[model samples]
Target chain A: MARKIDPDQREQHKAAIAEAVWRLVARSGLEAVSLREVAGEAGVSVGRVQHYFGTKDALLLYGLRLAQQRMEGRIRRRIAGLVAPGAEDVLRATLAELLGDDPDTRQAVRVWTAFLGRALDDRAIAEALFADDVELRAFTTEVVGSPLDAHGLWALANGLAAEVACGQTTAADARAVVDHHLDRLLGSPDR
Target chain B: MARKIDPDQREQHKAAIAEAVWRLVARSGLEAVSLREVAGEAGVSVGRVQHYFGTKDALLLYGLRLAQQRMEGRIRRRIAGLVAPGAEDVLRATLAELLGDDPDTRQAVRVWTAFLGRALDDRAIAEALFADDVELRAFTTEVVGSPLDAHGLWALANGLAAEVACGQTTAADARAVVDHHLDRLLGSPDR
Candidate 1:
């Protein structure tokens, strides 16, 4: 009888391979990411990568999904530690997470930017990337308790973060911009 | 003695080569942009492309510059045709221009996005892309009559446009988001 694969170990293997994909993408670009190179980057055999991800396109999409999941995890962790975080605080934490202040997230953003470049022409890629962004917008809408305001707020906050990620703006400047918009949107502090 | 160069023809040649760079980049990704490939795409000789751009790095950067210049020219033409355009009207036009409503712009954004991905890790590319964005912010500031608000406005508007370009948001949703933010922003209409 064939040995059963451990579900936990399978996830670990997939995430590890996805991490390699992100690394290669951040280093060069999406077009540079090949299964062979990704396998080498991850110190695994090409067969192992193919075993988990099946095809290059599937691997690329999975890498992006993993990136989104990781970002969401970061947001959740940051908010989890707050003693009494309000909606504004939660939103701030979320935006801050998106700023990609740390190395891992910054790398992820680089990977994302490259994929986003190709996504415009590739409908499947576009839909996958759009789904990730929609999740963010959905969370923002839930937090704001108003769909009308959330769209703009999500765009502004993530836009600012993206500027930071791409080095178009400083973290400080993005924070200031975020605060300026939030101040106008939220008005006086609730508590 | 070399043949005399016509300044107009020189610009046309450079723009044509750069346009080829954009098409290749938009079709594939920046990594796909090789000097020889760009020449092939432009139906020019490798020597001609090298003569104009010197190196692949210079060619890529020049392509981005040409793209930005074309966008500016478009924006100027749009605004110039407007009879007695107001600050709000001018801002709206600028924002709309950024929406990448046409195939050309949508393709350009794909190129920019790829560059932006690499820009995160490459200082030169980041600075070049940042400079383009800064010019847009400066223009927005000039229109807003307030530097304080321009950063937020520029980010929001372009952020919305980028979302549309990436297929992350519908043109309708982005426009509604822009109008919502602008309504809160501009207050009562001024004829």
Candidate 2:
């Protein structure tokens, strides 16, 4: 049975639930995310979760969207911070920022990877993510003056992110890979 | 109630259960795996799963171990099939084969990603995976003419795999990335 909660309280409750979900995903992986488990972790009633999400699938979708929005916002802010930057420099900075090992960036990457696991199964999320990927690639290409196709650039970027997240690459090395790829694409050996 | 099956029948049942589990994981990610669901998919009794695995966790662990072994076996076989090969060529061929879009390799990667998600929460699995990562990096470092440190080479290999899995880079593109990284590490002005 569900309870009739107040509107403001409900919004707060939803946010709380979402935060709990994020922590769970960050601490573990996507499989650790469960409606019942999340409710227990949040100190909220299962009925409240059901009231807000209706189903596990709905909750997952909401969480995924929220995560993506937060990432997009951060990237936009980073891009905005680069003052009068050449396209290549901006791209390099943005890529470095994304793959950095700072705590905040690490959390962001964790959330991103968790979402990636889901995106593999959910076509809606995959479509949205693929579009964003294309946008990111186009932006990078413009910045680097690269004639390579969006797919190539996106692959390189995404691959680098995965490697960094998996603890295989240091932040410095990831940045270096980006620099080299961009240099090759831009036809500038000096970059 | 657990079934009183013979040893041969039990072995067959375990294989069937593992196969069903693989299909579910590949189709929907690891979050969707459940013993009940596996039993249903395998057309077996729930008691049988309990009898064979003792617990859902056990089943998952066993299935993941099988997936890892299969991945190693495939990599070995692919390398064995090559004609005369240099260190650089062998490294590239082995990596390309692992990241290729072949069905077996794809399934192995999918299962690996799923297991990786769960491993974040499971300390035993996490330790084992880290140990495996160390060994893999050490082995890879010896190849490629020592063009990169263990960590750098491992990261490149991981990034390459992730890129291939996401359809972001072609086999040829992955090879190029490897070549570029090797060239940089080798301090070559021209490839």
Q: Across residues B55-145, which tens digit of lDDT does each residue of candidate 1 receive?
A: 8889888888778777778888889999998767888887766673667766766677667666766677778777766666787777666
TM-score of each: 0.86, 0.75
True contacts recovered per prediction: 0.52, 0.22
Worst 10 residues of 1 chain B by lDDT: B182-191
Runs in model 2 lying further than 4 Å from the true structure: A1-16, A36-52, A144-191, B1-16, B40-45, B127-132, B145-191
Q: Which residue pairs collide in model 2, if any? A: none
Which CAPRI category fits model 1?
Answer: medium
In candidate 1, position B108 carries an lDDT of 67
* Per-residue C-alpha lDDT of model 2 across residues B24-49, encoded as one tens digit per residue: 88888777888889999899899989
**Per-model RMSD to reference:** 3.0, 5.7
Tell me, by TM-score, which candidate is best.
Answer: 1
- After TM-score superposition, the amount by which residue B103's alpha carbon in candidate 2 deviates from its true location, in angstroms, is 1.6
